[model samples]
Target: MKLSLAEQMREMDKKAIEHGIPDIVLMENASIKSFYQILDAYGDVSGSLAVCFVGAGNNGGDALAIARHLYNNYCDVFIYMLVPEEKLNPSPKTNFEIIKNMGIPYKFVENDDDFDIEVINEADLIIDGIFGTGLSRKVEGRFKKAIELINDSDAFVVSVDIPSGIKADSGEVMGIAVEADLTPTFALAKPGHFLYPGRIYAKDVRVVDISTPVSVIEEFDPSFVAIDSSQIKLTYRNPTSHKGDFGHLAVVGGSTGKSGAVIMASKAALKSGVGLVSAVIPASINTAFESHLLEAMSYPVDDNGGFFSENSIDSILEFVADKSAVCLGMGLGVTESTKKVVKAVMGIEKPMIIDADGLNCLSFFVDELKNRKAPTIITPHPKEFSRLCGVKTKEVLEKRLELIKEFATNYNCIVVLKMADTLIASPDGKIYINTTGNVGLATGGSGDVLSGMIGAFLAEGYEPLQAAINGVYLHGLAADIATESSISYESLMPSDVIENINKAILSFFEA
Candidate 1:
């Protein structure tokens, strides 16, 4: 299960308390992990000063324990314990006394300027142990000034639990967070570790276990799953399965010069396990697609070259009615006629995939998607999503999960928003963060090939959700496999990726 910061914390606390592990011991666990991590980052310290910024809660307590460790390790570690000793949190109270009793010089600041200049100037390494997950407000007043000092310092800054002032639940920044060079997060990685402004502040990420029970997390059912290479394996077909036994997928798109789009997509579908594939292009380009592609057959429709005309929809629906599964909208340029053709095909109520030009068509008449009367998967990048929602691209990027969930539910479709980390959101609110592919799948026709491959799985009579998850996985796995062989994302073309699909699928089956 994919545990968020809050969920993991709740789970950890319940188990710890149930097992008679006091909150103090848990704090010690956190402190030990933090200290060890710091030592790992910068080890063999001969003589260096570590200035820790301590707050009022457990994070500050963690700082105090770390200070004790540094003292024992022969480093000149000091604490700028900002929260007053009189106002110290219970656990922090115990640790602060321990640090003070150990004879480490600790500074308590009541003024902003005095704290900033002092902490910044005297710091060799700044440890950010201020305001962990308990923070609900912004870092302002005295703390804000201190955070600024930590940010400006040339010292190596290590964040204890998380970067202070970044929401653990959501990745939203609360006022200000300490910009840490390395952040050692407890338990599962927090959303802030990979999401936006918070990610920007956290230069490096490391996950640590504070002795939380694995059984406790079993009870926590997280909706999001980060699909990694370490996850499921997708492998090639067995020797027993031949051309007819696999599956057949029909892709309807491409207008003349844009034939490469349909060609690329069809090739990927075939390579990913479809027994046979056919691209339904304009009647004029049938010979070209058929000639270039031996494994895939080409079925022709109306129009000379540019777009799928309104009159072409009837012939297309009739031609693909008996096909296993259908893929549409790769390089089929947007036109009034093409829109009419798409709407009619969509009306046929067949299991299908809609991407590229297909998504563009939906932006105009979003109502058509209202009643697909059948299952459909829609893959859209940021710009396409912006058009569909009639909002700015930046707005969509900012609230990616919200928009994807809303859009998926509204259209009764599965939404795959392609990004550095692709998000697959189902209509039921289940979201998957694909961790398989590297930046190598960022090329242009990459999306088209993905939709086609997914369509191949759909055509084979697999469950829609399963097909989607598998398709995204295989598409990315192909890129990952290709990348391992020296074909980086920057140099990868759609055609090049087709050869890698079988390898990726086989890898999954073996795993």
Candidate 2:
């Protein structure tokens, strides 16, 4: 689904109004849809006590209308207006008048002292509408107190649009944010609803269509999308096809102590439905690969003290010459000789996925990425990305979307910024946010598995973007499936994720 930024949503609303949908109509639709969501969650809110915290924006207007609907349904409703009635926006001002005429009990409060703690604690539900997508500053004063009270209470909370105080575009929490049990966003979900701290705050976000014209939304042409099963297009395997019909994948990386990384990567590649898989490693660890990898082949090259050296470059290049795609850098020690080999492999005209220590080597000379004519993909966590971009890890986390896009556009490659919420950026500036996988994937070898999966897809003739998206989504989905089964998050391993790849792929067909 398309994920909109705050500005894009505002422009969509403007275009909707221009297309003959009145602003009031949209408000009513939002309120009514949001009310139904409440009804769905709590079947009989007829006699429930609801305390609504209202601000001076359209989100407050939505709260007022919902409070009126609750009152009409025989519920006891109380409105705590943070701002004076006169300060409300035009549409919200109209809603405030209607509630006042209907005798909905309300009080103007300046701070936390005026709030009735007993009533709030006793309330069955709290509707949060103190702020909306336009919030650019930290929340304070009455609004902060209200959010604190709502969070402190046991009452079920519902937020309008997005959880107040969460930045709509970046998901950054402004000082404090409302922790809602549910958030009914209108038309489309904002990036904040799915990104980091905001996703945690805006829990169980449900998108409500408030009659924004389809044409208006399409005209906006949002660039960000959430990766899900609906976006996965799995190719049907021909029953008559042989193993060679799929494609061959080459896994190239391994040093003395990190040989397990290449083994895990090769195993994941074979599990990803690749026709054939091979690993090129230092000769000292060849026995380990031969013992662990049964279905895949390994080519051991000359090494200096069990680490890759310049002597292995010609042999490595010759071994991977016939491979369909190459997965580079998993446990490959970052040294001068290995860096030379990495550079030599980059000149080959095959789709390449660089990860782990490969990224570390590339960071030494990132401009080499622009010299490659073949498709290139780099999977880097924040720290690795920081090295490539010459920024701090904190800055990489803060400006990941922008940095990844800029790198992809400039280097002419696909960039996958791996994090809790993995972001995939194409050279064309399109971004796909993956909201799969759990804390279980925070272990070692996970990234290695991801590289192999993507390499397998690329070898199978999937386009660079599609391969990256599918690999990322399915990689997380496999971990999710493992955790959902007998495996606990603490016990979940990269090998377990590889084992569940078939199940994850089957889930797409099942859905």
Q: lDDT tens string, model 2, 307-344?
A: 89898899889889998999999999999998998999
Q: In candidate 1, which residue pairs clash?
A: 233-508, 234-505, 234-506, 234-508, 235-505, 235-506, 236-505, 236-506, 440-489
Candidate 1 lDDT over residue span 455-488, tens digit each:
8888776778777888887787788888889776
How many clashes in each structure?
A: 9, 0
**Candidate 2's error at 158, in angstroms?**
0.6
Candidate number with greatest lDDT: 2
Give me the runs in candidate 1 sitting further than 4 Å from their true place. Answer: 5-8, 11-15, 39-48, 115-125, 134-138, 153-156, 174-176, 233-236, 287-294, 348-350, 390-394, 436-443, 457-462, 470-511
Candidate 1 Cα lDDT to native:
0.80
Model 2 misplaced regions, further than 4 Å: none
All candidates' TM-scores?
A: 0.85, 0.98
Best of the candidates, TM-score: 2
